[model samples]
Target chain A: MREDHHDQPHAPDHPMTEFEWRVDAVQALLIEKGVITADEVRRAVEEMDARTPAQGARVVARAWVDPAFKARLLADAKATIAEIGITVGFDATIVAVENTEKVHHAVVCTLCSCYPRGLLGYPPDWYKSLNYRSRAVVEPRSVLSEFGLELRSDVEVRVLDSTADMRYLVIPVRPAGTEGMSEEELADLVTRDSMIGVAQARTPALR
Target chain B: MTRVHDRGGWPGSGPIDKSEHDLSWWEKRTDAIASLLMSPEKRVMRVDELRRAIEDMEPARYEQSRYYAKWLHAIETIMAEKGVLTREEIDRKVRELSARR
Candidate 1:
């Protein structure tokens, strides 16, 4: 009889350790083949880590200054993002959701981390973790609390499930004060977690 | 001498010659295969399930890669083919993919 192991998926479930080993072996083999240099791979990981969507930053900036653009972003994110020179397209579509003080919104790919990457950036480890994925849909309030965001029951907690055709990024309500801030300054106000609706954009603390 | 400049590493970093990296040809093929398999698919999977899918595809030569890699690749390829990723975007994603460990 053939070895059943060949036909079966590995047992013991969620073998992350084994998984890491396979990655190591694959990397080692790649190194042996000269397909990718160690430096290239290292740079790649760092690049991935450092890459935040400046395009996304611009989008938030526009939303802060241009009412028409904000209207367009709310109407259709893909087009509005493109209008601002941030070209967003792909198997994954992008949609911008809004959050007001009275009503807060959050996004979760209860299925996967189906984020608006073109307008966002690298997903945080927490976004891709099982803890966030599983709990967000079932208990939005508790999860938001852990992330340090709490909403009153009167404030609806809308959750959007990112799918193949459409993904979401949250456009938070601009913070109070600082009406005269520059575009770059406003962009600084937009954080990755905020765009994903996990947290709110915080203005600098008062003196 | 005909000038050819390297553009692999991020800005302010030195150039990256795809050649200097010491991945094996077989390993390169594996990486390519991994890259191809790792592109994003139309499927929506839970994080745990996504992890399992990556684990399952790990040894398939062309069928499996880490979950995020394959997922990103598929999305890249599909979008590019559809004119979604665009030429510049494709180049960027390729750089991201190559740089990504």
Candidate 2:
């Protein structure tokens, strides 16, 4: 569980801020009023913490190895993922964008940190930064460059802006020279940044 | 006018900070509470309402606030708005908790 960027200033040993105190008070009052129980909150925390990019990596690896599953995923991401036992608890529609030989796709929620949290877990701090929110849509190539991803001139870059009701998952093109690798091995190459389209999947030689 | 929270395509923003830190206990607790409040079974508040509250914030405050802090602020605002909790009660509880520390 990575700490959010703002909470960095006040470590656990440090005194709680007014806002942190308010968070505690809010939970206490909610429980007292029967609005929510302590148990429910604990369970919710565990559920959220359990989700990580590993889930998305598995999905990517499955898509890489299984053509039929890839077709199903690209056609309908939410239902397809649910078929593999990944529950999308939220109501938002997830669209899986594939990176082909001619096109690349990236995702950003310019309005807020709206992401495919149900699939990829909590977004990283940089994804929520104002810089990413502002620039990802306008200058995706340069942003990708900052992440050390240089795409060929022939491959077009399309930045998908996620709204509250819609999200995107980028399925990076499979890396070269792993023709005989199993799904589990391929999953290891699917970095979180690759799924976000800032970088490509790791090549077998690099690994 | 483009709102602060709606920051797409606005120019001159600096480099992104890619560093990550471990979530503090309270931070995780805050996330849990917020998530439960918005869950289907609870329906205490919707995510859209939370986003609206955060967007309605003053620009300077919105820019300065942290990710989960923004979430906390929105949760506080919505809880108060829906009469699920009152601002006075929350403030009083905060004061009481502060004194105990």
Candidate 3:
């Protein structure tokens, strides 16, 4: 159901940026020569769109309720996540680190904006911004405080740097007094920020 | 070259713009093309390689362009380097596409 831009002429009055023109030309040529089809491009768009925080919440939810799944998530995240039928575009490894009362894990890609895009959708604007890349690892506690998440002074913060080959996912601690909650109920506490380790999972009252 | 696109610990930061805005059609297309270039299923190129290509951009252009613009630069550069699409052909196609509009 995508619009066909093949025949549309740009109104001379409205100029496109250089990159926009380049993409148009490159895509058109690629499609014409059969290197890649518009369908493939459309599928890529849909696949990226399909990746959302809900998927991450689902994974976090299961991990919270099932110790076995949580163990597998920490030991071999890609394999276990795939077992649950989730596929991210990149072929790199994703490692899940859990937070405990004694320690917290915060993820950052200092090199570039490496992220678990398959699970969290596009990294938020803040995630990719120069501000986040610079501050996340250098002063994570302060960063979290800005996100309204002030970790206890004694909580050890482990900043995980993601390389091109490996991404990191932070599994936040399960909130207290929720033993009777179902996986779906537990999943509701999981937010993108919590999974990224900037914030804690939502409490029952917040929902 | 070392800094490349690495913004880690570079400088002070202003407030983050938290408002979410929808991407334009071209930006979405650029995203698709960029991701498809590194699709695990299709395997056209490594994301590191694309990063390298992007890093090779003129320093000013690298810093001045928007993220999607950088993606376009990387994609076009890598495609040309891989012989998937020649630079001239892309230029010609751009002219054709623009003329259509």
Candidate 4:
């Protein structure tokens, strides 16, 4: 009987919880009813798995190297990102906020985990945590500091709340040095935290 | 009126948990299920509808469930509401799977 469980898809070492079992049951029934095919589920999982911070890094690196593209990304993020071959299936508008010496920007979806999943994969656990969702809007400096990003007094901190219809991706300023580095190399320096605006892009020395 | 799901600026929510774990197999499948159901080709439900379901959860239950678990709750709620699947059918399926184990 236990072996039968192993034969099942996504069987865990321990017994599945009620919620976990419900997830399986939902999928099974949905497939049975022809609402969604197993193949479609597999394809969706693969598509989501394929998306990662790397894609967002590629976009940011391009913006760092190309002034024209940066302007376009800020002007129209949804279409500009699509031009780079990243498919955004949803209709939510993505806004690219630039982090400069005078201003810093961080993103939080206070209502729910409304991230730009099409570009940066799923939101991190902390991004969806109540602490972040509650404090990011009111006390962004403290939140950024916990992420090891200490901004100077002169820099204005802006916390962008991601709504159901709007998502924000922060473009951290390029680190000092590495003047002649290639776009690929620059992409390597763009960490996920940096793009979320909790931290800045990695300096060349750190990379 | 602020709902339980609307937690912006609620104060003293504590520090952000930086730890991250790889999604469990069921969690991944739940996400995939949601994406496919809400995909343009299927249009069985919209993201907004799913979100509304989540927001409609009781405050205590909403806070207790894990992230993907909340999504599952939402999916089940929407499915039942849309007449795609009933709670009774899902309950029976769960029992069937449990009996096999």
User: Which candidate wins on TM-score?
Assistant: 4
Across B5-100, the per-residue lDDT of candidate 3 in tens digits comes to 676666665555555656667777888877776777666777888888877888788767777788888888888888899889988987876676
Model 1: residues with Cα > 4 Å off, grouped in runs: A1-53, B1-101
List, residue by residue over B1-101, the lDDT tens digit for candidate 4: 77898899985699888999887778888998998888778888899999999999999999988999999999999999999999999999999877877
Regions of model 2 farther than 4 Å from truth: A1-12
Residue A6's lDDT within candidate 2 is 30
lDDT of 1 by residue, A71-176 (tens): 8988988877888666553435677778887777888765446666545645665665545666677677777887777777888888776645577878887888
> For candidate 2, lDDT tens digit of each residue in B1-101?
77788788887887777787767667788888888888888888888888999999889999998888888888889998888888889999889877866
Candidate with better TM-score, 1 vs 2: 2
Ranking by TM-score, best first?
A: 4, 2, 3, 1
* Fnat for the candidates in order: 0.00, 0.85, 0.71, 0.84
Q: Each model's TM-score?
A: 0.58, 0.94, 0.89, 0.95
By DockQ, the candidates rank as 4, 2, 3, 1
Q: How does each model score on lDDT?
A: 0.56, 0.85, 0.80, 0.87
Worst 10 residues of 2 chain B by lDDT: B20-29
- Runs in model 4 deviating more than 4 A are A1-12
Enumerate the chain B TM-scores of all models.
0.28, 0.93, 0.83, 0.96
lDDT of 2 by residue, A1-207 (tens): 121213224554887887778887888788888898777877877888887888999999999999999999989999999987898777578889999889999889899988888788778889989999999998888899999998889998998888758778999999989899999999999998898889899999999
Q: Residue A82 of model 1: what lDDT? A: 81
CAPRI-style docking class of model 3 based on DockQ: medium
Greater lDDT among 2 and 4 belongs to 4
Report the error of model 1 at residue A77, Å: 1.6
How accurately is candidate 1 docked according to DockQ?
0.03
